[model samples]
Target: MVTLAEVAEHAGVSASTVSYVLSGKRSISTRTRERVERSIEQLGYHPNAGARALASSRSNVIALMMPLRTDMYVPVMMEIAIAVATSARAHGYDVLLLTGDEGPAAVRRVAGSGLADAMILMDVELDDERLPLLRDSARPAVLIGLPSDTAGLTCVDLDFVATGALCVEHLAGLGHRDIAVIGEAPAVYERHTGFAERTLEGLRGRARDLGVRLLHRPCDPGYGPTSATLARVFDERPGTTGFVVQNESAVEPLLGLLRQQGRAVPEDVSVIAVCPDQVALQASVRLTSVSIPAEEMGRRAVERIVAKLAGDDADDVTLIAPELTVRASTGNAPG
Candidate 1:
């Protein structure tokens, strides 16, 4: 293994000179710097990240805590994760992906151990258990999902409330009076995930204002659960003429089930989704939908954390506005 001492000896300079050249803490003469650089290249001497972090007090790493649960869609989570990783890299930081459901302990461990300079949390519940620790810790954190309270936190997410309301308004405007929301899996709602709850809040609130009858059904991912949920919605509201689906797993199943039941989309019923644009476009039916801005949310979360790390202190929740695209799958209610 090549050491700094070897590079220093080879360059005919002191070890301190090599340290200064690597850290740029102090200016060195151009000739000396060039000679050290040549020696470093020739000897293949690389400064250790741990040593650099200890000296600078910054690891230049971000910890992303994302719990992989079966109930939620993996692709969307992966999209956001990829975005976060790439964005962090662009900002000269590496991502330490912590896929455990470590709750608050993960934060304490990472923050205390100096393994990462900051954190970005995902799959946030409305009243998250990790918030208190994050609030008290001096280490910077940014959430990709919004919590019920944002008083002392930085968060970035899609405006799912507006997302839900937009779906309702789109269907309602098409004269669909009875709208059914195909929500996330039962466990997701059971845990009171912030996005799911807020979306429901907006759906119910807007439904009341628009005089639209709304039925919400929490469905597991796959054909069987979606089929059963659809049956229940139809049984409860026989006049149901619209659907607002938030589950990516259920989109194709719902579309297929509707077809099997002899219902033509936009002719007998209209369906819209709250999902990514890729999901909307690739569905069995090109869905009229509110696109989830995963990339933007991920990028913004990193930006906020980077800003905070640089002592910017601009702690505030950022909600990306929802954009609903009208595609092939929506139209007026059945006459």
Candidate 2:
């Protein structure tokens, strides 16, 4: 009989990867899955019948808790949800979306009712209200965002702190000292959402280190609100020549507003953003930005949950590194 380790070696992957492929317990790339299946065929490998039967005894579903809030950018959230759903399906599991802000009640409900074998939480707070229940629950759970505490939790997310500092570093390196951070909506910051909070923390901390002035204004979605925020940024610091925008909705509007004020991009002012690649590319100005790895976050969350189910030792914290792409929107500061 061909062993799992032999099959893994044949497929050029780890033994756990071969097991995950056979068990359908984790999301594997189509190419890798195909290669593994081919290796299994060549080796006449058969998965353990007893283990498959035991795995089938559970609900085989994963619950995703995501609260749809007005302050959030829905497209990015939906993109992540779709990624999670797709990845879960690839692992031979169905997804049950719990899109309500039920807090710990949802955690308790899912765990107590045996509704799902595992859970993946989104829109996490630094001090999430549901962490206590999740930590104590017998079920496996994964968080797509980091929290302040991770004593007994598995989390996967972008390193927003590095992202913030990277954005500032890019602008400051170009000689733009007074920078403005047009951030997410007031409600997002008020809620202390993990991503927003971390980005602000990194931006402020790095500004202090670099001896640069950072102006952060939380702006609502829409042209009027963005315009208002921009006016205030200039009002407070008329010398603001560089921008680090975190809000997806405000990117284009800020650019348009700046253009309307007879300011040529990179000539009079520079703009950099923290957003998805498509957003950065599609902007009126091809935005210099740090791409948010939403799909990667969703994918890693599923892998962690599946690894836990497979009784493998998974890391408690997984942070994807951020990379900044410089494009046409930013340039040397004016004298």
Candidate 3:
């Protein structure tokens, strides 16, 4: 078998230098490091995982806790998970996927067993059950969503409040007075997930300030529920001329229903979405949207946890500013 000693010999460096290159405990010259890496690759040298862990006191793995619920936007969640895995790999670590169903116990188990060097949690609620355990554990951790109290936690997420307000401002600027919001599932609000509640809060506060009559409806995912929700929205506010939809599953359905009702988009009504850019571009009509930045959030969370593991204190909450893109679905309010 190709060994570390052989790689070191081939690279004309000491075994200790090769070890330092692998562990990153000490810096080696860039040229020397590159040479050692090339030799290791050419010789197909695979280090002993157990030996490396013992030497560094790190498993070189990161645990990612994701929600198991289907009610939320599954595509976005999946994209974040994929991004976390990819980014973690780039940082020389592997990812351990744990579902939210495991709850706080999972956090304790991973921390106690040294199964991972750090953790990144997703789908965080305002008062998440895992927060206390994370705070008490020695393992470094970062959250992909905010909590009610961010006292000592590292968090990375889009500023959902600003995102919501941006959507309203765009429509209101175009002379939209009566606007309706299609929110996530009722269970989402009942749980008081920070993002959902914050978005609603921003939307309502801005709507009031802009003198726009806003109606919000929590919608179940699918054609039937969305149809009923749309009907109720118009029934409650007959003059509604603009829409801010947070529910991704309901976007296409809402557009279809509006067409069926003979409402010409932008000419009769304007629509805006708070979703990933891909969703906006592929919709039946190109949608004006405030992007969720799922991949960026995931990448930032992993980076934060990795930094924390390296003895960097990462206790601050980082909120990515929201950016709205204009497209075919929005226009000046009707005459």
Candidate 4:
């Protein structure tokens, strides 16, 4: 195996200089940095994570907790993973992804074992049961979703309230008075608490004042359930001229159901969704929808986590806005 000493010798620099370049404790000139990087690439010298952690008391590993489901949206997860990995690598850190299936045991294992210096918790709920555990953990942590309180930990989330209102305002401007909201689920258990319901509330409030008839329906994350749910939504809300889908995971199933029902996109009914573009495109439906920067959110969350790990304050909550991307899926309401 190629060693750091080989890279340092090749780069005409001391081993400590190479370490400094790797750690970013001191800034090296671009020219020297490039030489070191080239040497590292040539030697393929990988740092010893265990040894590094033992020396610095920082594992340089940030734990990412996500909801585990075999049927979970792969693209969304990929985006988050890429962002977290990229952002952490830039700061000389690594990411360890831990799924929800691991549960409280996983939380205790990661926190108590000191395997990670910090953590970034994703898919948080308004009334998250894990919050108490995370708060009491030995490591510092940040949440990627909005929780009830932001008093102590760092958080990053989107403004779902504004997102909901924007969806209504956009449809209303298009002269649609009757619309239907398709979401993940209603807030019942810990299952349905996040930006989805908040956004729905925002949309409903705005739609009411505009005399827009809004029918909110929940679509199951699965294909069969979502298709069946959307079909029911269409049949029950016949007066609905437009549809706004807040759940990205169910967008594909919704599109499939629309096709099965012989509903032409934007021609017979207008469609808008709150999801990423890749998801919209993957469904082969060019949708006019609110785009969430999932990757960017992951990256920012890791950056904040790393900062907090480094004795820096990540006290503030960062909220990214949704960007509306109009595409072929939307058009004027049918007469």
Candidate 5:
């Protein structure tokens, strides 16, 4: 492999100048930088990751930790991955995608082994083990989800309670009374999975004020609808005239099942979902939903981390509001 020395020699510049130009340690004229870059391309000179880390005492790489599963978070994960990669590249950094199953072991391995300069964590729970490890780790890190204890870490997330209340308020204004809510299953294994449930709480609280009862059904937290779960919902709450679905994974299947049961959206069963706009758009019928700004959230998380890295005072927590997109799927309760 061609070294920086060969590229520098070919470009007629010293190795130190080439290093400075590549690291942006000291600004070289644009002309010289361009010449070095061209020489690097011609000679196929790739910077040594280990040597670079040792010389600079920093890795130009960031680790993104999430669950790499297909069911709960594929869409959201894709959004964060794209945004984080793009933003990191713009700032002269690269990303290392990691999964939740690896936990603190991932952080320890990456930072302790000089794999990355920093980390971005996702899908955090109320009491995530990674939080403490990250806090104590020498590397700077940011979280895409907030923990119950937000004492020192920087976090970025959506205001799910507000999102839920907004959905209920939107439907209530259209004169819907009896409503059915489909949400993620209550977290069973010490998971911080209350985004949907907390939103339902807000909706139910508002529903009480409006003199209406909100019927809730929690799905099994999968990528598709479970007939057994849906049947239990309908059986227990037969009077539901509208629906609020929280799981994007189950959105299509639930809609299909609803159609199979001869239910007409808006006219017979008004619907609203807490999902990304892309998912809502692909539905057989357009759905009115509280669109989660998945990409924006991810981008913002990276921005916050970069800012902190640059010695800027970053906010301890940043909450993004879900945007409501009104469509044909929601309307007045049937006569």
Candidate 6:
């Protein structure tokens, strides 16, 4: 095996210099770094992982804790996970995915074992059980969602409150007075998932300010539950002419049901969605939507954790602003 010493000899630099370049622990001139890299490539030198860890006191791995629940939107979660892994690789680290099934013990195991340098947690609840453990642990960590109390925690997520308000504002501007909101699963609300409740709070508060009559219903994501929820919504407020749907799974089913019920979108009732841009573009009716920025959130979370591991204090919350894209599903509310 070609060793670091051989690469250092080829590059005319010391082995410690080569180590500094690889670990980014100290500044190496661009010219020197380039020379070291070239020497490493030409010599087919691969650093021993165990030696590197011993020298750096870092495992060079990041743990990502994701929810195992089936009720959450799986596609968006998958996208975030993929983004985290990809971004971690770009930063010269690997990812360890731990499902929520392991609960707070997973946090302890990873932090205690020194198996990972840091952690990024997803699907955070308002009062998550893992928060206390994370706060007490020495390992640096970042959260992908907000919590009820953000004291001493590093968090990165979309501003769901603003996202919800943006959806309501768009509909109300289109003269949609009687509006309905299709929210996430009942279990999600019951669990007090921070984003879902925050979104609802923003929507409701803005609707009241806009003088729009708003009705909200928590729904399971599928045809049957959505159909039932839609029926109840219209039954409670028959004059409803606007909808703000936060559930991705219900988006298509809602559109299909509206068509089946003979309601012309935008011409009769306008709809706005909270989802990824891909979902909006591919929907049966192109939806005027506020995007979740899942990939961006994931990338930012990893960046924060990386910073934390590099001795930067990252204890504040980072909320990405919501962006709404105009598309086919929304128009002037019908008379």
State each model's CA lDDT, in order: 0.92, 0.89, 0.92, 0.80, 0.81, 0.92
Model 3, 51-98: lDDT tens per residue? 777776888999999999988789899999999999999999999999
Structural similarity to truth (TM-score) of each candidate: 0.95, 0.83, 0.91, 0.81, 0.89, 0.91
Over 142-237, each residue of candidate 2 has an lDDT whose tens digit, in order, gives 998888988888999999999999888899999999999999999888888999999999999999999999999999998999999999999999
- lDDT score for candidate 6 against the true structure: 0.92
**Which regions of candidate 3 are displaced past 4 Å?**
1-21, 24-43
Candidate 2's TM-score:
0.83
The better-scoring model by TM-score among 4 and 5 is 5
For model 6, the stretches where C-alpha displacement exceeds 4 angstroms are: 1-43
Full candidate order by TM-score, most accurate first? 1, 3, 6, 5, 2, 4
Q: What is the lDDT of candidate 1?
A: 0.92
The candidate maximizing TM-score is 1
Candidate 5 stretches with Cα past 4 Å from truth are: 27-38, 186-190, 221-225
Compute the lDDT of residue 167 as modeled in candidate 5.
Answer: 85
The reply for model 2, stretches above 4 Å from the true place, is: 1-56, 313-315
Better of 1 and 2 by TM-score: 1
Off by over 4 Å in 1: none
lDDT of 1 by residue, 232-298 (tens): 9999999999999999999999999999999998789899999889999998889999988888888
**TM-score of model 3 vs. true structure:** 0.91
| Number of the candidate with higher lDDT, 2 or 5 | 2
State the displacement of the C-alpha of residue 224, model 6, in Å, after optimal TM-score superposition. 1.2
Pairs with steric clashes in candidate 4: none
Candidate 1 weakest lDDT stretch, 10 residues: 67-76
